[model samples]
Target: MSPTKTSVAELSGNGQLVYGCDYNPEQWDPAVWQEDVRLMKEAGVNLVAVNIFGWAELEPSPGTYSFERLDQVLDLLHANGIGANLGTGTSSTPAWLTTLHPEILPESAAGVRAWPGGRQAWCPSSPRYREYALRLVDEVARRYGTHPGVRLWHVSNELGCHNALCYCDVSAAAFRTWLTARYGTLDALNSAWGTAFWSQRYSAWEQILPPRITVSTNNPTQLLDFHRFSSDELLGYYQAEADVLGKHSSIPVTTNFMVAAHIRNQDYWAWAPHMDIIANDHYLDHRLEDPTVELAFAADATRGLAQGQPWLLMEHSTSAVNWQPRNIAKAPGQMLRNSLTHLARGADGLCFFQWRASVQGSEKFHSAMLPHAGTDSRVWREVKELGHILEKLAGVAGTTVKAEAALVFSWEAWWAYDQESHPSSDVRYMDQVHSLYKALWENGITVDIVAPGSDLSGYKLALVPGLYLVREQESAALADFVGSGGHAVVTYFSGIVDENDTVLTGGYPGAFRDLLGVRSEEFLPMPPGQLLPLDTGATAALWAEALRLEGAEAKASFIEGHLTGTPAVTRNRYGAGNAWYIGTVLDPQALRDVVAGAAAEAGVAVQVTAAGLEVIARSDAEHTYTFLINHSDDEHKYPAPGYELIAGEEVSTAVVIPAGTVRVVRSFSSAPPTTGRISGLKDDESD
Candidate 1:
């Protein structure tokens, strides 16, 4: 079948920032619908996500359905010139279906089936569940496929967020079938799994099952395959629904992904191709850490998933979420900053989780565009102001964010690194990856989160950290990238194993041993809080590797330890470029120093040198738009002068951007000019 083809502009109300929230009219009375429409029009909301979790309302009983309420909401939105992102409402099943067929419920690893109290209670691999879910989806699509008010079709909401893995018998049967297709025979499965290690070889296809609770620990290979199977099962369900929607609807279809570090089960790289437009839901971790840097990482990753196309910010919170332990509301102006940040990266649309605050539910305390305090509250005021800003910044809808640096992030590697029996239980994959990404982020460098198969020709530097598992083809790709004049920086625990989690035979860092020009004698996994001295007057902690130079030169050595006088860092020159190896975790200052030096050698410019300011550039064929956001508490000065896009004021000298504020400047020069007036603000000229 041909791919689902639809432009993002068509989905966003003719190329404006689709500003709206999840609207559940069924939750409120019919009289309240008028107020909802008035408040939405006042805030400049042009799109509304309707009936996301309305299975209980749409289908109250088997073969019995009702669309009286949804029809009214759709008519009301269309009359007000607002578009609707229609939801199939199959995220949760009705209570009657689950009660009649209890086998549809998923079971945990301990063999206990979940009760039908929460959402996502059905097993994805169950045949009965798929049959019923698709029936409802077909009805929804047929009813509103050709409606003029419908802009897009939103499939199931946040797939695999809660029920990613099911250890029921149904899932086991599906897993066996999947393995048969992958391995072709039991002998091949035995060899790939290395079953000879513990006398745990399988002789028949019927012997396989999901990795349940064992006496001690399950086999690592078995667990890895289970993770892969679980992700595929959820993707299968999404594809089934997308097929139904494609048969009747011409609008784009998308399902939001929980694209945060907290969610690791779904491989978004594999899931991206199935979406006509990639959408993500992100939430800040309220643990006193700065969320702006991590938010940048997530945005870049989402852009990469879109393959440089503009994606959608499907769901984000205006304030604190009620689900957290201590829910603290966002400070003033933070809502505006957060919304602009995603747009500055590559988002074509900005949306919140909810439109109005709920009166009674589990998420009643969750803040929305319209809080319970009417339009007089702080959240509501900020929401209205942000909507106006989005209307003005419509020029940024179709442009692409440009980044010269790329970070190699592998979901397969993340899964392998998280398994048991590693060098150190303290080594967190994302923590190390964030160390490199945060360093560049602090230095005002924009980066793209590239995976193993991503195109690397456009980037100047590629940073790989905590890549414990690497395929042979992936190794060859990185080698070709560096040989073709791309600089690379590789960290420890990379290239040690293949796709099957099998260690390489020759030495440590097997695949990249030649490219990085270093070989490890032994791994020095240190305890927490213990620091090892380095030659650069910096301290290394958490883990270290005793290294010897092969075709590389040592950059730093351990001062005191069993690996004293040994190389802790090395650099090697290849055909047209160079590769640097970081054998140990460097201090924050040392990391910044090394990365800045390498980037300068590669002729990569640092747009903003100030510590507290962030500058992201997005461009079309004509103009480059620079977004200068001050994330710190103190005021910072921007050196160059440009025309501020928002205020339409010419900045001839340095301007002071206050705390939690944003300034977008348009630059006309093809090459970055040192200092000049940014003149292009007209719509025709900017594009």
Candidate 2:
């Protein structure tokens, strides 16, 4: 069978302002149903996500069903002309099912069997759990699959949130099966895991155990496999739910993914092809974060996973979330500006976390459309205004934006870092990746965050920061990428391990040592308040690596430290391309210079040249759409002329913009035709 091709119309066919929020009428009185529908219409709400946590209400007992309340909820929504993103209500199993089949409860990483109370408490690998959960989904789909109000199928709520790294008996059995499929024999498994080191060779399948306690201390190979198994176990659950839902309903199906979610190993990327559309929730502590960085990360994650297809911003707080240490209300106009930011970054739909404020539970204090106080509040007014504006700009929904550069992120690298007994505790994988991304965004470079397996032909430069683990297969693929004349930047701790998280026997950076052209003998973690002098007559800190040149020339070296004469950075040429290796976590200024130098050498071009302003573009054969976002809190003026998509106006030099504002622009030219010169008119000589 041919794969389904998703397009602008198919993604946004439901119409503009596909406004939706999670609704639970099960907590409200049936008499108030009509009032809720009236409130929805008044706010211009067109879609409602229902039955998210309705397991307790729908199936209170084994083989027993109740649909009176659910029927009224769906009927009222359909009668009001509102569409529904119908949920399967299998996120949390009912108490009765848990009491009957105790095996359904999940086991924690520490090997403790948890009782069924909180959400996502079920053991995903248990057959009994799967049987009961699949039956419930089938039952729900049979009843509501063709309901007039249902427009999309929400498979499960925020999957892999709780009990992510389960190592229960059921999971243990499945892990062995997974291992058998991957490695054909015990000798193959033993060889892959390097089990001879600790005399931990597995003589039988039963001898192999999930990495819970023994694997963490005895073998990094087993621990890495355990991580892989845990990710696949959760993915199996998601796929099972999708299979059941797809069997009955042809409507688009999706599950919300979290930003930089580590528990699942880019399994969402693998699942993207099976989904009708992708959706995710973005929650950041505004006090500690630059809004630009947070939004850029969210958009890049979604765009990367969907391969440039517009995704849904399924959940965002209307005002303040209760979980942060200090729950502060959004500054006036902040929410509105952020909503526009999402659309400019290629979001097709906008939805909040909730419709009505909850009166009970962990999220009761979170902000919602209608605050608990009632509809006359400022929060409600802001929401209504946003709804109106979204309704007006509905035509822009499903539009594609263009991008120029891409960043390569690998799950194997993530696993590699987690498994490695790092030389320093401060060498964090995600933090390093984020640091590079922040720099790129600040320089107005459009970036696409991509997985290791993705094709690298479209991008001119691919940045791989902190790639500690380079799988054998990936090494060949990356070799081909660089061989075809692509530019790649790799940093410290990269190429240190293989797919099994086993250290490469030859040197520090195993397969890539030749590509990077440096052989490192030791890594020195710079203590706080310490500095290392570089060959460029610059100082850097945080950490440093001492290396001897093999083929590449040193770009920088330490100056003040005991290992002052060591190489801190190096570059090597291979095939038709080159690789740059940064050996330490340098300060922002040094990193900026290194990245700029690499981009210059690669001849990569960016859409904009302003600091703190990000320009991303997307195109087909005919036209290209560009997104210009002012990520800083201070006002900025543009120095070039471009047509704005949202305002339908032209901007030239001296065009002023407030903080957090976004401008969408369009162009007709193809790749790099106007590389050096600004197209049309100069900033000073416009119109």
Predictions in order: lDDT: 0.83, 0.73
Candidate 2 lDDT over residue span 1-687, tens digit each: 112234423433355656768888988888877888899889888878888888889888887989888998888888878878888898998888888888878887688899877788887688998888888999998888787778888877887778666778888899999999989999999999998887788899998877776444647778777767777777778788888887887777877777643334545655667667778787656554565476767777777777677778778888888876888778666677677667666677788889889899888999988889789898889888778767656656555555556787766577667544678777778767877887676555667888774678887777888877777777667767777887788888888877777778777677688777889888778787777667786677777776888988888877664776788888888789888888888788788777777776777753345455555555546555555556557665554345655566776543455577655555554552222112222334433
lDDT by residue (6-59, candidate 1, tens digit) is 556566677766787899888999999999999999999888999899888889
RMSD of 1: 3.8
Model 2: lDDT of residue 351: 84
Candidate 1 TM-score, true structure as reference: 0.96
Clash pairs (backbone) in predicted model 2: 401-617, 401-618, 402-617, 402-618, 403-617, 533-558, 533-559, 534-557, 535-557, 645-664
What TM-score number comes out for model 2?
Answer: 0.91
TM-score per candidate, chains pooled? 0.96, 0.91
